[model samples]
Target: MSSGPSSYKIFDVTLKESVAMTPSLQHCVFYSEDVANMARHAPDQRIKVVLPLAGGEPPCLVDNGGWYPAWLALPAERRPPMRTYTLRNVRPAQGELDIDFVRNGDNGPASRWVNHARIGDRLQLIAPNAAFDGNGSGFEWLPPDGVRQVLLVADETALPAALSILESLSAQASPPQVQAFFEVPLCTDVQALDHYTFAKIHWLPREEQPHQPYGQSLLAALQTRLQIPDDAPRTQDEAAQGILRPELEQMWESAAPAHSAFYGWIACESSGVKALRRYLIHSCGLQRETLSLMAYWCHSR
Candidate 1:
């Protein structure tokens, strides 16, 4: 599992530049002469960024310190310090780094910083950190010997990580059959993704006048579309869980009896991911070792 760096100290850094990923997302690039001073980082890892308060200061270190560590070791008001974001890309050789921010507007300091960020802006940085891999290895049960297919299911938040994994997997190994389900607001959000073996990408578009939060409904529909027949004898109570249970049953009903294998990756809203994880483990009889499940973001957090 990951931990704070041995050389834990703040770095005075500045925004080298920023660009638009979408109308609502910005890619902020930062530079530091002290880049070599930080610890090694990993994809999906997070770091804290301090933003100056309105009219409090301009390019000034307003918070008690220039920058503070977030998501780890801090006071109460600062408990959930700075918005936690993934390290999108890094270049140690060039002394540059990039983190993409989902523009949620002034509701958050981090979001606000990104919304107004300009070239040469200054801010504090808690050196790049790594993700916790409590299991002590990479995706242990995947690529089960002789397995030749891959399936990735996720929302926009997990898209970066999913793409990185797919590109790496496609380049070195014989391309595995891949399918992806992505949820995004508009059609333009669809862009070139790395080619994988027999890839089929499904896009679930957001509504103009949203009938409801479309992600939940899309996931519910997927559950309905993938359901197994009721006759397979297992447990009676399995039918009680809403929406996703039948999909799990269907996945099990469709699988081979013995060693013919499939690898699954899923990340999404917390409740939905948790539901799928339970179904994969309990109802489908999938080894916890065989599936990669992550709750990328929570609804109410």
Candidate 2:
């Protein structure tokens, strides 16, 4: 494991509340009076959360009076577990940020901690600096210019980021037409999203069909909704399409021109994401520059 710099500033936060979005989904809010600077974070970006391990040392403040994360303060061998969660919403006026956690019956440390979190419980958050230093932050919702339509697909783990992206898009003066598919464990897991007038949301409940694997429902929905060409090219020619790379970073930086009208973004379990990426590029004929595919998590890992 790698440790962050000792000089890294960690914000001390207190839990505001943990609300049940559904039987198995939770919306956790944490607030810090010093987080007004968080307004600089792009919508749907992620934050590193450091929760104290059971029986670990309490958090402390550095000479600058900024709280240091308890997990980071521990010796390398004793550091607590840490996780990254999406910033679902930010209220700079109240210095609050919301993170949605899906409880899987204590299968993961973060889920277990969030399941029992209460009001006024202290926690620590490592956020991107106000200057936007391009470190310790992750954001990938980049739609190039002239995109007029979008297709978004995600499972429950990525629902928070997907919703945040939708919210950001809806705030635009002329929002693009959006078709979003979300797969969740329960139908009730589908919550209302405000200011999403231009979006068509589809909720798929996997609990209704026990044998269906994660991401299959979303893939089915995509197949039914989009008209994938039967004779679409399997792969773009390397000489004609410019140098192709396997990494998203390299593909994203390539000076390839954007697809004319449609953009697609998919995030979910690793296997599903890879399958969807292949289908979109080879079957749907979407340009690599117009789609963003990410493996939010893996079921087998």
Candidate 3:
């Protein structure tokens, strides 16, 4: 079962409930008896959602002629709009899935729809055939066997995926040392995630640093707090004391006994992600293979 555009499947869902995770974040749960294998999806993957157009009916399936071509062939008035969203959580027994949307007014179709969505409102989604690529679902998050420490950075847009990854990691037999930093518009936006006791969660409120641009605060924090100095003493005590950056650097230094493998996952706005990726690779000396950096969205010019 190889997953690709051709392996997409349509599922009909009814909005079971909607909850406000923050002032601007809405979490919607959709249930469908038709989607029996909900648990097969990997954490951090995404699903394509198709919203009704004009007075069209809900849960309509798109022709499997490829998304763009099929969408373009439809009449202007009959075409449905679609958006990709992270599959936040899934419950196979209950046939439920969750998606979190940022309520940004009418700036985007998905936001507008989520802002007004109500229980029982129907919708359709295209999900990957997990039977084919369960390990690498639509998004990739694979840490090597020796990885014993993980760093996660994300903004509001990437929060869903980041949290899902955290949850998945926490479920392992021996979870790694997890450090996560999340940037949100307001302090009220921070949600409690007690499921993972090993993760040290840091919430950065944008409102606190009004002068700083988006992502700058996060980058600065990572550099000042997380990035280890190149000249720091090489000792296991330093590694045990939370400085895994230097430990990672020692992995390639004369084949000395390497400390725990360090891995980083970052997702944010385009410019921010690029800058962070550069800092992790060039400045922190982290191997590119151990890091995953993605620009979930770009700032509007």
Task: List candidate 1 segments past 4 Å from native.
Answer: 1-11, 37-42, 50-80, 127-147, 194-198, 221-261, 278-285
- Report every candidate's CA lDDT: 0.56, 0.70, 0.73
Task: Give the Å error, residue 108, model 1.
Answer: 2.4
Clashes of each: 1, 0, 1
lDDT of 2 by residue, 189-217 (tens): 87776458898888989887788777888
TM-score of each: 0.66, 0.81, 0.81
Give lDDT: candidate 3, residue 210: 92
Clashing pairs in 1: 228-250
Off by over 4 Å in 2: 1-9, 56-77, 132-137, 193-195, 227-260
Superior by lDDT: candidate 1 or candidate 3: 3
lDDT of 1 by residue, 1-301 (tens): 7343433345567789898876655778889886765553334444546555455243233333223433333444444334445556677677787777767656666777777778888776655423322222212124555455555666666666666556556675466666667666566666566445466666665543265453564465446543322322233344333334544532221222233345667766666676666665565545444456766666663
Q: lDDT: which candidate is best?
A: 3
In the range 1-301, model 3's lDDT, one tens digit per residue, is: 6344355567789999999989978999999886664433567787888897766466365656555576678788777888878988878778898999988677676887898788899888877654434343566566666767788889998899988888888788999878888988898998898778888888888888897777887888887767443432233343332433433432111112133376677888777776676576666656555667777776784
- Native-structure RMSD, model 1: 7.4
Instruction: Give stretches of model 3 more than 4 Å off.
Output: 1-6, 38-40, 54-59, 65-69, 130-136, 227-260
The superposed Cα distance between candidate 3 and the true structure at residue 71, in angstroms, equals 2.8
